[model samples]
Target: MFKSIAHSLAALSDRFFHRANIRLKLFYAMLALIVALIAAINGAGHYIFNRDFLGYLNEQAQQRMEDMVPRLEQAYREHGNWDFIRGQPRVWFELMKPAIVEHNGVVPPSGPPLTPSDLTGATLRFSLLDAHRQLVIGYPNIGPDARLRPLLLDDTIVGWVAQTPFENVIGAIDLRFQQSQFLAQLIIAVVAVMLAAFLVVRISGVLTRPLTRVARATHRLAGGDYATRVEVESGDEVGRLAQDFNQLAMTLERNEQLRREFMADVSHELRTPLGILNGQLEALEDGVMQPDAQTLRSLKSEVEHLNKLVGDLYDLSLADAGALAYRQTDMDLLPLLRTSVQVYGERFSQRGLTLTAQLPAAMPVHADGARLQQLFNNLFENSLRYTDAGGGLHLQASLQEQHWHLVFDDSAPGVPPEAMARLFERFFRVESSRNRASGGAGLGLAICRRIVDAHQGSIAASASPTGGLRVTVVLPARFEEQP
Candidate 1:
């Protein structure tokens, strides 16, 4: 039964917590805390004040009784027994009058002598009793709650003085004061709670505003609105988050633009070759063009262009999916570099450009030879397409602390510094018109980057000292056999 009750309570608490928003929870928590603190302080203050006030009243009553002791002794010394003062109500009342003691041992008048009627409504009430406990004067009925103090003369009990308990009257006054203070404090607490609640709500709104904007922007982003952005207003973590969100949106926008451009470029490239093939076939069928070697060669060239485009697309797709095939081996890079340079040297010469290579005897690397060849081929093709006639191309290789560094620098008309950073982005072309004339598709550098990355290497492009493009390749060197 206890376990079930506990479980039910826990579940109820959990539901309440889950349903309450952060702002409401914080406001309620702070309000409850402040109220509890004020209640505790007010309760303690009232308790302490009442205790001390009652004690002070008791002390005053005792002092008034003590002052009457000396007078009673003097009155008894003059008159032999109770006959002199027994029937004298005025004398008893005068003896009971509260007196003030001064520094010079002089008894000053406290106030006008209190009458028997005044004692009824006083804060401290008293009764004077004879030696036999009979009421001589003052209040007739002494209640059980009254404190009794004996009047002594020469260590002999002559009579007794009884004081009414101060608890009732002082408590009434203390209660009135306490109630007034409680009401005032309650008002102040209400105002404080309201102000605190407003501040809490304002602060929570400020904190959640950026998050709300990010959430809204995310929804817009999902709806294909990549241009959505949020305003950044502070230097805190939330502001940083907004900045990141904006950056992500900007990147998505750029990628979307690139995607559209890639599709258009692909369609155009395929259409050109397919259209040429269709036109030539139609011409042949209509006998508009003879079935000569030139006509056949032109058809073959278009087919080859279509095949190359399809293959390049396939390679890029595989690379994107991380499914590209690689047959890595420990091989000397010098042979591969020499062979590629030799193959592209003629093409460079045909373009009226000079190609030079400064290679080591043998630099070993752990890499896929075919991919390396492809990477170098792409760099060479880029130079062939972009470098003007009479431009110079230089390839140099060196060993640099566990890595082999290969640099390809060409002469004249280097890429802009800003554009150089984006050289390896797919479908980026510095000279769009020249690329179309050269029958180039601008995926070469991107593929080169992918190949180098797959080999756990780095590739970068910069402006060469000779006023042309510079491409640097770094590959991890294979340690030679110690034998």
Candidate 2:
């Protein structure tokens, strides 16, 4: 039963704390600490009053007893008998007051004699008696523990003055002072806790409001609302977090736009070839065209174009999924470069373009020969398809800084400066300069970029010196193989 109770308490507190947000948590923590401190101060009040304050009061009582001796002796000498002060209440108070021209440590002295009212109920316990030990007109209850001092006249004992000291003086005062002090502490603690709670609420709210907004925006973003944004009002970490969240949302929105465009372009590209093939087959079905070599070739060409587009799309998916296999070996790049240039030379010439080459004798590198060949093929195709008639492509390879530097500069029909940065982006083409009529779906350069990245190299596109586009490829001589 005890174990179950403990477990239940633990679970209850855990639930409560978990459900509380940062502002409430901070406010509760700070308020608890301040209340505990105030309780501690109030609890120690008795010890302080007993060990220090009460001891000082007792010492003063002893001093007062001594001060009264001289005044009583002088009073007896003046009256010669106890008749003058035997029943006088006013005279009794005068004698009860201290004869010293001084004051309590706190209350300042006004004139001559000082009053005994501040003695903490000690004055009312004083009494006078004759030499025969008979009680006079003061406190009636004098017990055996009463302190007595003699009145001597010419060495004869005349009478006595008695004061019964309280047995538990400090403990008695403790009761009276404790109640008053507890009330004061309760009021002060309440005010202090209230102020602390107010400050904690304001501060914690300031710190967590931005974070709360970011969390809400993130939830909306996950729900496909990519356009959500947060207002930044401060330069603290919370503000920076909001800024980073805004940037992330912006990037996701742009990517979503690109994804829609990519689907539309793929559909258009597929429909063109498929529509041509469909029309040709329908014509053959209706006997509108004879089955000749040229007619078959035209239908075969449309099927081949559709097949190539599908193959390119499949290859891109494999590359993006990191499933594209690469077989790396140490090979001289000069032969590979020469072979690709020679193979594409006829095509460039057929298109009324010149293909020039500047090859080093032997450039050694660690690379995948087949992928590098594909990268070179794509670069050449981009120039051949897009450049107008009479323009040519210039290929240059060199060794610099332990890297294979391959640059291609083609003539005429330059890319726009704004489009250069996005040249390797998938499905991006300069419609103003390199029209859609001359280019495939724009996946060639993006695939080239992925190939370069796999080889742990870099590729960039800029303006060609020959008034066209320039492509620069840099491959490190040696690198670790990445999985």
Candidate 3:
């Protein structure tokens, strides 16, 4: 039965809270917590007051009974029996009065007088009994409920005085005092609850405000509003969350810009070669030029350039998506580097440039050899096409601690300092130094970077000490046997 009730309550709670907004849910949660605390404290206060207050009154009654013992003994000594206070309300009242002393500078009256403050019914609830334990007078109900004190006369037993504590608070003044205490507790609990609710509402608002803004901004960002951002209000977790959200939005915005630029660059790169091919074919068809070896060669060269551009674009896309096929083997990069240099050496010479190399004889690494060769060939081509006549290009390699470091330094016709940072961006060209009229379509270095990254390596470009562009590649040293 209890389990079913608990399950019902849980389902009801979920129904209310599952669809609620965060701020309202948090407010209700905090409010419930404080209300439970208030109920617990109020219950504890009531229980303690009911128990301890009665105990306190009982203690005061016992003290009064003890104090009246000696007085009763004195009365018994004077009257020779319990008959003096027996059935005499006046005598009993006088006997129960508190001992008198000087009040300020005045003396109390010389009589057994009743004070208005003794409202615990101690005077009337008392009983006197004989030495044989027979009740003389007082409250009729006297049995196990009595608190007894012995009366003594000259070290001998005289009689007994008994009292009953104010356990039920029957008198008007005592009942009012008890009721007032309960009322005061109720007022305090009500005020505390109201104040707690106010403070919790304000606090919940303060905490959830930034979260609300972030949620809205996230929705906007999902809706393609990449420029969405939130103001950071503090240096806390919530503030950091806002910072991260703004950063995500900024990244999306930047990526959107790059995507548009990529499409434009691709279109321009394709249109140039295609337009040239169309123009040449139109001239031949109109009989404006002879179909000789020179015309055929020109047509073939344009087709080759267009084919190379499309191939480079395809390879770059594959590399960017991490879908490039890598036929890795245990091969020394030195041999591959030398092979590319040998192949490109003639081309560099044809362009009136000298190529030199200072490579280590062997550098073991587990990598895609063909991709590395492609990387080497592209670097050589970039230098081959850009360097001025009679200038040279230098290739060097060495083993750094746990990695192979290769540097390519070529002679003049250097990349501009301003373009160094974006040297490896796809389709980027330096307008001042390296133009489209120069040889590369500007994707070689970008592909090289992707290949190096796939090998768990880093590539960077800087101003070479040789007054030209410097490309540095660092690849981790590994072996198929070691793995």
Instruction: Report the C-alpha lDDT of model 1 over 163-257, residue by residue, as the tens digit.
Output: 77666445677689768987899898989898889988998797777777888899999899999999999999989999999999999999899
Give the runs in model 3 whose Cα sits over 4 Å from its true position. Answer: 1-30, 56-166, 170-175, 193-216, 276-307, 325-330, 478-483
Q: Give a tens-digit lDDT track for model 3, residues 302-398.
A: 8998898899999999988889999887778887888888988899889888889898768899899889988888888888888888888988898
Error of 1 at 98 (Å): 21
Select the stronger candidate by TM-score from 1 and 2: 2
Residue pairs with colliding backbones in model 1 are none
Which stretches of candidate 1 lie above 4 Å from their native place?
A: 1-26, 32-189, 201-219, 290-293, 321-329, 346-354, 387-392, 411-418, 432-436, 465-467, 480-483
> Candidate 2 residues 104-165, lDDT tens each?
55554564444343446566667788889898757778888777888788898888887766
Model 3, residue 218: distance off in Å is 3.8
Ten residues in sequence with the least summed lDDT for candidate 3: 112-121
